[model samples]
Target: MPLSLAYAADFPSFADTVFILPAGTTELPINAAADLPEPVRAYVASQLAADEKLISINQYTHHHYYVVAEAKKTADLTAEALRKAGNKLHALLKTDKIPELFINDLTPDGALALAEGIALSAYQFEGYKTDEKSKKTPDLQLITLVGPQLSTEKVQELDGVLQGVYLARDLVNMPYSHLNATQLANRMQAAGDDAGFQTEILDFVRIEALRMGGLLAVNQGSPEPPTFTIMEYKPEGATNEKPYVLVGKGVVFDTGGLSLKPTPNSMDLMKCDMAGAAVVTGVLTALAKNKVKLHVIGLVPATDNRPGGPALAPSDVITMYSGLTVEVMNTDAEGRLILADALAFAKKYNPELVLDYATLTGSAVRAIGTEGIVYMGTAEEQTMLELKQSGNRTHERLVEFPMWDEYDDHIKSSVADLSNMGKAEAGAISAGKFLERFIEGCPWVHFDIAGPAFLTAPDSYRGKGGTGSAVRLTYDFLKRKATV
Candidate 1:
């Protein structure tokens, strides 16, 4: 990831420690702050007087130096707060070059938050930088958590989760030229090997034989053939008989086909279109590494949508894997096509639940900026509730929409079973309704992560490129599901 997390059995004394105060009182806590050098303590007090949200101070001694931060009062250290604190520490490390840092006097939850913040905020996409050595950002290689509450096991688990997030972020940030359909499947295969999972890649020949018309139709334009990647992790004594199937839209680059996207920033960032697939890959890696007692499956339908020869056009009718004819009213609505095939294929497993993630629609983005995800599903209320809770815990908040039968009417076509495009209103809901037609028996949830998947600007710990939107959300959900 952006930074590595280190642990120590006990760091009896470290100059650097974050001093957290409660919301109201400014009095020095009866803790480590008491032992800090007088000048450092006075400097912290002065910064507090100036109303600094976070203040750092370093005082040199004969052998070593001390680093301290005075933070504002927080009644209960929430995950977000810890993350923010971590971000503050990360900034200090980069800008001030404070080599050794310690987090003192935080509860288990508080320490985890700070760790998440620091880890998540430490990402940088310098893969193509030529002056790599000269321009590399100074990294915080070692972080020691000082307190009785710190759990070594929990810290390790969080590190695994961060590795997955970083992997997804890296995949999403890659240029489409470098990450094609075949390359995506290869990457998944490599990840499976590293994470102790099984991977199967279906090339153009296999995809055609299976009659995945939706994936094929979307891939008609690109010279780079399509690939369908399947990943599985099922161990003995797994909690569920049926696996949880995850489908991701791996449009490596979406040129919007014949419809074509607007020039510059609009189409330029289309490389991030495959973020959903990256999330699936990352989540599977985490689950495998953690050895969670649950069986899971991930499917990525990979391709690039372009206006090359034989590109899909408006009103084109194609039969999905489920044998339902879909009239493609808009070529740009391609994610659902590949996802439909995968969802239908998921029926083979009789999955307990099938969830698909996609940067599907602009309407969803318009409905909720980068604030949250727009999700709709036919899954049971209890399952949906669990997912919502997971989303909140991971800060990948979900904005649920109704999946009423009336919304399905928008996708009805005269000749085909359904149309890819629906009415202008509630476009996101209509897209979910369309995918619902393919899943006949199992419970399902369609995540329109368009809004929060990629950010034009950075948001806190989430950097400027791929946000790795739903990896944490799904990981937390599956962990809780495993226990239940």
Candidate 2:
């Protein structure tokens, strides 16, 4: 990817792309803008005004969305509005090169910093040669601005957070052909050192002693050793109130164990099964880098569900760390089984909050598709409201769901204490219920991102790969709680 510089008095030579105001374009978009290059503007106008019968609107824009008047209304609000609108443009306007937005807001550094985070998140890894030509992405990087008040310290702070987002995306986008348990531990260790956090990668010997049955059971089927990564972020002037505990199900590669999944796309991208880990890892990195005055503990149970000599089977009964015996009714329901153990472990810390995220159920994909995070937490309306607001701001959609006891009857087992999977009807709801059981009464939140973690098509701030979901929403939620 070649890099060059240009000048634009009409915009500015320093501006890679100028924010535009198309002819007769009105309304202040709190999310998007009426901006485009000369060619892009003409292309958008031509498409809106097609051949035989042209659509009639005083003004026109791209065909990507329905040219909503709402996007136009959002642009003139606050820096928060401008920054969010910039997020949409950063993804929607990419051409031969990656789309990058350089704003001239003269805005507060906080808002500009958020924009940098958005652009950094719009990253892709396509170094590996492939047959799919369109799969290749533009190397458009770096959103630079020239402002008298833009301090060096502000850019450094924004760059650190942006780097954390890219680091998480890199880990999520990397194929399992390269990443395993040990490799994942090494990645976290490197991030931990770089971000001023402490990473303790527990090897198989320690994992066995701790009896992480779900993690061990998943790894038993694979030759690769399992890793339990514990990261602690304790900043200065932190409060004694319980810290946030984040648990991720790190099934490095889930082959469905004895109960193999029907043929699907599992060649190179299975490594993203640890996306929860990647997100939590990145959040901790940001917190540590900024020296956020809070306590955050990240728990990742890493392994692979495979079918080998020592693999646990459907009829097998295993003891989870929580001291509950689970009947492995189906090996494909491995994520919850692992997360249950970690969630239970989190209780020992007596934390004020615990949030666990996973690519838990296929049914979730059927529910919300690939653009939202399915969330169900305790009866904490204010907390959920904060999460949802942050989700909207960060582009990590969080939708609330029910976690009632109506489905508990499904898990009752004849052979063991409980069955791994219930009747397939409410699989997503059942998975949430299963996680809630371990949280016991803690204000726990469960995010089943099965639908949104991976994309089959292009989305905002996303390409054709692992969309680094949840990081922005959760991080923003915590930052609001911390600083706001």
Candidate 3:
């Protein structure tokens, strides 16, 4: 079940309570301190004085618990730091099996950040588990923010974003057997239905009629057909005249086509190849749910790249939706192929800005492990700066790489308009250059999210498997745009 979050005017009488305070504070809330025994209060004070970050007082005899989470000093506190602290507290509560809890909203932003962490950390995917008992997740389901600073609107916004993130993670973690191209499109349609967005899914015949050769080439191998999903949210009196376009590569499962990836490490986790699609879907869902007054459109080209019948092969030249021919130098480089079609299709909207996200290259993962995203773009400097700021604020950090003309030269094909794969050097940048061709000089940013999109093990609040990497970052950026 999804975790529930609400703003409480007063603390609950019987539920465990958490005091979220800034570091260097020596005292707890008066009412809370009054409830605790004098000795325990002194112990908490001593712990705070010693700069202990978390102090837990478990009174098993009384079946009550109190936790003091001292966030960073006001001067040192960052959005990311507070979130990390919230993740730690979540772990403690889950281990103790606390069913419900109240957190003192001493600091408004701080409280919200902690709540974001706790809610995100509560996600689990055990849908296929046969044993009902083994499928149980954390009992920390209800979280109430108790303080004057929090508002109903803020809590609702946070809940909407959390729902989007959870949805993204769930879709990413699902195996291709359960989530194929058609199913992925169906899920997006369902999300639009629930979140009040408009969804138009272009079926295989429509895709072929549109002459999306790149997507068609990749889908030739799979028994299932391809789908191009377009989702839009435009409220009355929106902020932008030209809608912001977000495109995601939706290779539901990538076996590298005829180039067949090795099963050991490369192909085993291919279910996450569509993480970019998940992020786009998540962002749209959040924006619609929160009623952000900004016109935004989402484009996703989805299909699995398998080495089955008539799979794409090297030296095969294919035409994209933009009518530009691409020489397939390496079939493993299939992400840019489908994304090329989507970016080209974005031209119909005459978007103010276009941002494409994809697990497009391994060079990106090697350049900067799973710690950050690798991006290069043609967007204006101010736009890029604002995006980077949003990324830092959300902890989905970005590293901008140079998109010089020199990199574009690497993708120039002898036979086609461009080559899908460039020379091994600067593989990530070359992939960006390949997609840049389809954008046709429109302002655009390309994100190579191969690194942070999926994790083999849990990492704090991000958890194991699909991390929902860029969903929060993109949503934050668009949210700021709406406010402006």
Candidate 4:
């Protein structure tokens, strides 16, 4: 259970009341429902129904109920309630059969955690199993309460983000044989359509016409064709809200081209190269799935960085959409090259804010270990504070690094406008700087989720697979921005 909402009256270990509720039960009073704070009350009344929507049920094992209160829902309460309810819900499931339970009638946060639980529990990438020995994962279904009124907006927002995370993680966990570039594009299109968004997969002809150098050059090494997937989300009633644009580097598999990586496990996680695209695609999915009143544009520059006959070389030069040329210092630094072109492509919208996520460098893992995203923004950085607040709110985390001018010289190229990579001193920063070149005249944040995107073991509310790291952090940012 997530401890964000766990409280002492029911769950002793958790100091807050964060937990999940089961399906089909009567409305029960919480032990301390009467003593809730003014803000919490407003959160509950506005986000959760007093007695009409969900009966603020007390601590009970496997008990779920909804009341018939005529009221509105708020975002904060929904988030808090879901966490509080999840703690209790998990406790109820201890040693018992994992129920394939789904929920309805939640405020935003309430829905957030439920969606989180869905994404958390839906992790299964049993690709290389010679013997099929299976047990059961907690089969949980969620039916959220969203409408014109009395519904939590942020909860719906996070729900879309969670869906995107599930899609990405599932793709990563799936066997590579079942997921090539074309297959990835098809799935991407399907996700966009299902989630109430528009998806477009640019074929090689279109990509070539647009000069998507990084993505095309990288795919020259693979038999599979490259794809530049674009998904857009536009809500009918949303107005005056600047669209949030996201770009993900979806190198479906990175063989480092001719400069192949050493070590036996080098190729082990290659399938996850598309993780960045997965994040944005999933984010768009959440936006569309929840019918958010926000405009979002997602760019996925997807390709396989494999060494093929026409693949990029050690010292190739390619022009990006921004009209800047990059010397391929190392073909392995292909993520940034592809990102540069995509970032430039997204500038047409002049997105109020542009964010990019990529499994860019290993040095990021060396910096923050494997539990947080390595964030790099402008001199007047803000995501650090935002991420800290989000950590408290949604639990996904990020650690910001200085994007100072001192690192500028690191990326100074000898040939062409710049090089795809720079000195080895601060690889993460160099990668960030490389991407920063693509994002100009806008509020931009770059997240290097080299670590924490996937986990080796389980802990707290996460399990032994992709943790769906920034989905909640991004949702919290959106929620905070939305309410303000």
Candidate 5:
């Protein structure tokens, strides 16, 4: 269960409480330590050893619960440390399943990080489970922070961002049966309604009428039709004259079309292929909720790449939304195809800048497995630097792949305008090179999140399934733009 967070203005005394202590904190904050029972006081003073540990103590009167969480001091508090501390605290809470946790004496940054760790650590995808008791997770219902500087505004903003992350993760983790293109579009529309944004979903008929050949070519395999989602958020008094466009590749489940992936783990986690779309939806949700003073647009072209009847195959050439042809060298390289259509369509906006996200290439995953996002951009140096800084701040570190002109040679086709698949070497850079063709010289950034979008094993605060990879990174970038 995701932790519900709110600022407790009245600050009621709960039967269960948690004290967050800094590193080497032998004594708790005076207010919290003074109210603690003698045994709990002695235990906190004696046994609260170090950061990244949680100790729970019980009181004799009514068996009240008292827990102490040790987080590294502010000077030592990096994003990784805060996340680790939150994960440690969550691991302890799983055994106790505390309904309400009140954390005392935490800074706003620490509280937000802890909330992220707690919420993400508690994620579980048990949609298919039949047994009610067996399909349970920790019920960490509400978490309240007690600190002098923890303002209601900060708490609300953090709560909104956490909700967005949870939503993105849930969308990415769902099975293809439950979250196909149409269903995903519906979910996007619902999210837009909730966040006061505008959503327009164009179905297959509209897609065909618009001649989105790339999307059509990919959907030729699956019985389920494709969908193109356009979402926009323009708050009153926004500063930007033109919107910032975000495009996402929405291959719901890529079995590689005619060029199929091998059985087992390779194809098993294909449901996470839509993580790019989920992140754009999530970032827009957060931006809208906080009413960031900037106009933003999100475009998602979604479909499942299966090997059913009339599936796309190698040597086939298809025209894209930009009226340029692409040689389908390998059907497995389908993400850029769908994304190409959306990227071309984004040119109509005349945006200040454009960014696209995708779990596009396995080479990216091989390059940096679960460590960071593979990023490349043609935007100004300052913009790119800001993005890298945002990634660092959010702990979604970026590994920059060069956009050298030499990579363009890898995608040149003998007959068609370009080839979907490129040389095996520097495969990730070649894929980015192919995407650059559709940008029409507009300042743009691309994020290949294949490495960090989904995980095979749980890592620290990121759970075993979808990691909600780029939501925080992109959200922070936008926030910086709005404020700076």
Candidate 6:
């Protein structure tokens, strides 16, 4: 069940309460701190003396509980730190099967960050589990914020962002057996309906008419048809005249086609290859739900690369939507092909900026592991710096790579204008350079999300499986843009 948040004028009688206080402080920050029973107060003080960051007291006689969560001092606190603290509190409460709890508000920013972390950590994907015992639904469902600092508007904005993150994670975690190319577009349309965005789905015929050769070539291997989804969110009195375009590579499942990937670790998590598409959808949803006054557009070209049909093989040269030919050196390099067509298509909008996200290279994962995003772009230095700041604020950190002309030489082909695969060294930068061709001088950024898009193990509030890597970072960036 989705967790719900409510506002309370004061701490309710006989309700379990969580007191958020600064580190090393024995006194609760609430006005009713003196009203607690002597034994509970003594126990909390003792736990604080021992330097326990979290203190739980079971007041069985009073039929309630008290959880004291110590946060970093205000001078030392950051958004990421508060979120990590919330994740710790969530784990403790969930383990004990606590059904509901009330939290004393700190500052507005601090409270909202804590709530966001708890809600994100509470996410569960048990849809495929048949047995009831196997499903691990979160026990903590209702989170009531008690205190005046957090306004209803602020809480609503936080709720929208959390919902977006949950939506992104759910899409990435879904097996291809349950979600295919057409279904992915339909799901995006459904999200648009719920969030007040406009969605236009272009079927295979439309794609063919547009001569999207790169997308079609990738779809040749699969029985499923391809879909190009366009989503627009333009609120009244918008801040920008030209929309900011976001393109996502939607390879629903990747078997690497003719250049098949190994089954163990390489192909096992291929279901997450479309995580970039999910991030775009998630960001649009958050923006629309929050009613941010910014014009944004999202494009996703989706298909699965299977070897069952007439798949493109090595040494085949294919044309893209931009009328540029690319030699298919490795079928596993299919993501850039589909993304190329979408990036080319985005040019019609005369966008202010274009950003494309994809799990496009294993070279990126090898370089940075699952800790950070590898990005490179032709956007101005100020834009890149702002994006980096947003990433840092959300803890979805980024590591920039160069897009030097030297890397462009690696993708040159004798038979075509370019090659799908580049030289073995600096593979990630070469992939970015390949994509830069489609922008046609438009300011653009490419995020190689192969590393942080999914995780094999749980990481605090990010959880396991799909990490919803770029949603938070991009949403933070867009939100700031709207205000500016």
On lDDT, the leading prediction is 3
lDDT of each: 0.83, 0.69, 0.88, 0.66, 0.84, 0.87
Model 5: per-residue Cα lDDT at residue 5: 82
Score candidate 5 by TM-score against the native.
0.94
Worst 10 residues of 6 by lDDT: 61-70
Better of 4 and 6 by TM-score: 6
- Candidate 6 lDDT tens digits, 5-69: 77777876667677666545665544535556777677767777777766666555222333334
Instruction: State each candidate's clash count.
Output: 2, 14, 0, 44, 0, 0
- The global Cα lDDT (0 to 1) of model 4 is 0.66
Candidate 1 wrongly placed segments (more than 4 Å): 12-15, 19-25, 46-51, 61-77
- Give candidate 5's whole-model lDDT: 0.84
**Cand. 4 TM to true fold:** 0.76
lDDT of 6: 0.87
Please give, for residues 1-94, the per-residue lDDT of candidate 4 as tens digits. Answer: 2111111112222122322333232332354244455565555555343233333432334433332322226444345445444444554444
Q: Give one digit per residue, the lDDT tens place, for model 3 in 1-484.
A: 7898888888856558777775457777676665678888888878777777777887663223334444444422366776777788888888788888787766545778888888888888766988877778668778888878888888889999988999999999999999999999999999999999999999999999999999999998999999999999999979899999999999999998999899887999999999999999999999999999999999999999988988888899998889899899889999999999999999899999999999989999999999999998999999999989888888898999998988888998899989988897999999998888889779999999999999998898998998899998999999999889
- CA lDDT of 219 in candidate 4? 80
RMSD list, candidates in order: 2.8, 6.6, 1.8, 9.2, 2.4, 2.1
lDDT of model 5, residue 484 = 66
Q: TM-score for each prediction?
A: 0.93, 0.80, 0.96, 0.76, 0.94, 0.95
Over 224-286, each residue of candidate 2 has an lDDT whose tens digit, in order, gives: 898988888888787637788989878788888889876666524466788888888888887
Whose TM-score is greatest here? Answer: 3
lDDT of 1 by residue, 88-202 (tens): 6677767756555666643334566676887788777756767856677655655666567667777777888988898899899999878999999999999999998999999
